[model samples]
Target: MTVPATAAGRWASLWGLAIVPLLLLGAVLAYLVATGGGLKTLQGPPVEQLKVSRVTLPERGVIQVHLVNDGPQTVTVPQVMVDDAFWSFTAQPAGPIPRLGRATLTIPYPWVDGEAHKVALLTSLGTVFEAEIPVATLTPQPGRDLFVRFGLVGLYVGVVPVVLGMLWFPWMRRLSARAMNFILALTVGLLVYLAVGTYLDAQEFAAALPAFWQGTPAVLLIALLTLGVLLALGGKRQPEEAPLGLSYRIATGIGLHNLGEGLAIGAAFALGEAALGTFLILGFTLHNITEGLGIVAPVVRQKPRFIQFALLALIAGGPAILGTWLGGFAFNPVLATIFLAVGVGAIVQVVWEVGRLVARNTAALGAPLVGWSTLGGFTVGVALMYFTAFFVKF
Candidate 1:
């Protein structure tokens, strides 16, 4: 019943292909077991680590805290203290929180306005975790009033400015070839600044997450993955592809960046920082006007219709409203960090594509790509962004 040599060779090849994956899987299992699944094993006394992921003042005299167990074992929060005074509190899903598990604790404390307060949690393992409120103010609750307020902010910061910038399309269409290159270079500069800022913001948010989440590595991986995916999606445009396509892509990138901006504003307001939120509105309004120019640069040559321009404006600015809603109602540090990373990646992709367009334009004009106009335009773009950023603070 032995198989023929030809059939036996085919079977051998199939087995070989299957064995490679099987061996690799076995290796992964062995590595995981040896490293204890990348978790630190407590060697001595009960080790507990807790993270205060968020704090909210839903009403005038009550505090809500979100907690996550970021340790190697289960930990129970047995006592709570506010401002060094013992206070009674209730925990949702009362019990010990296992590794990476989450819970919410509500405490009724008469916190005064314009003052600082400290909330402390005493764990079963005799470890204390403290969360500080730098300023006592009422957190924004989800409601029609809050929704309308956030919407107005987004409209001012995202939509109005972008539409105004797009208004320059008529003027942009009249520029010389050399001048067009300069404008495109300026767009690249603007996008580069945005990308860097978004990435830094992502890192900041990542640092606020629980230690067990490996936030830094996660941000790096997600940002890189986003960049790779976007590049693949926009690898090369065919001649038949309309210029509107490129413009839409640019709008999409700017829209994502604006979404991050909206999240920042909403979170600031959620934390009751009215001043910071107001400043953000002003700063982003100025900063994002330049984004409209970037979006329209590719399409000006195409002479796209008015309806097309309207679509571009919406595509570029509409996300801010959605972002505000999420950040105001359900802000999560991990989600915010991921979104910022995505914005960074999208902007980087747009910058690459825009740079290529600039280079191509320069070559068509038989001029040097890195001339004075390009350099100066880029400098001005970066400088403008930096100057506007003075309004946005952590």
Candidate 2:
């Protein structure tokens, strides 16, 4: 029996695709063997790269740093300096750290609260790496007390404000078509700010990533992928269709943004910047209050049930708690950057959807798409977010 031409072609394609990766691996293996597992080096000056991944204050007068070796050569932490003065430090698993290895250095110094500090590490190869502490405070460890503290912070910053904003539902029911158009347009404005700000934050984290990671490109690609996927998921709805679905999508996008916010707050506290964290909480609380208005904009005509409201709040605010936990305990630059990118993408997609809704509403009411009310509402939304953002400075 002869195989069908289509089946034969499919098999050939699959086999050819499978062989590509094998060929790539074989090439790498050949290079590794030929170069004696990369031991044979070309003529060049010695290269050393180290990253101070984290700095923690375990207790008063105690400074701890986590370092990662990212270069081809082994790195040794021989000397440490604090405030431009040499300070002695003890490294766990003492000795040179091979490439991709990690080490923790413990230094005992009198670090004062609310004061800035700089810690520098000198490698044996005369290379220096620096980490900064903008404000000195105790880094909270994992415990019940810490959990409760972070939970409260997330609640105040992420959950309560969003829910409070949602309470505008009753009052929004009384608004006329023009007012509703203003609100939907305002939602678009808010989402635009969020998308831009979130992407900027992702870029900031991406800069801290190791060069090999190519963090900026990865973030951009991931964000674009996310935006495309979300847009596709929305399908081809009618211009004014899917109010309930739109509301949920808005909540989900805002939830992702809140997740990034929680991560920042948690990381700030973990890095011993309590004052900065507190200010973030205040700013984010005010910033997120408007988010609820966006969430309910579509459902304003529908009179969604109480349970729907609760679910919307939870959907929009729950990730923040999980983000705080991750940021405090297992924060990684790569992960943080990815999450921020996802948030940016989601917010951007939501902005597009909300804009469509606003346009549809305007068309239904025989008003110009970009009327005075819409422009005014958009301006108010952007201005509100921009001003509130002042309280949060990285």
Each model's Cα RMSD: 3.5, 3.6
Candidate 1: segments with Cα more than 4 A from true spot:
1-42
Candidate 2 residue-wise lDDT, 1-394, digit = tens:
3569889999999999999999999999999878868766764777999988888898999999998887877888899999999999999979999888889999999999878999999988788899999888887778998898788888888889889999899999999988989988888888888888888889988988866678889889999999999888778766555898889888888888888889998998787767777888888888789888889988899967899999999889887887788777678888888888888888888888789878888899998888898898899889888987877754
What is candidate 2's TM-score against the reference? 0.86
- Candidate 2: where are CA atoms >4 Å away? 2-42, 60-62, 82-95, 108-117, 236-241
Instruction: For each candidate, give its TM-score against the true structure.
Output: 0.89, 0.86
Superposition error at 227 for model 2 (Å): 0.8
**Per-residue C-alpha lDDT of model 1 across residues 1-394, encoded as one tens digit per residue:** 4569889999999999999999999999999878967774744687899999999888888999999989888999999999999999999979999999999999999999878899999998678999988788888778888789889888888889999999889999999888888888888888899888888888888999999879888887887898899888775657557468878888887888888888888887777777888888888888888888888988777868889889999988998887888778888888888888888888887888888888888889888889898888888888878887876754
Error of 2 at 187 (Å): 0.9
Q: Residue 107 of model 2: what lDDT?
A: 97
In model 1, the clashing pairs are: none
**Top model by lDDT, which number?**
2
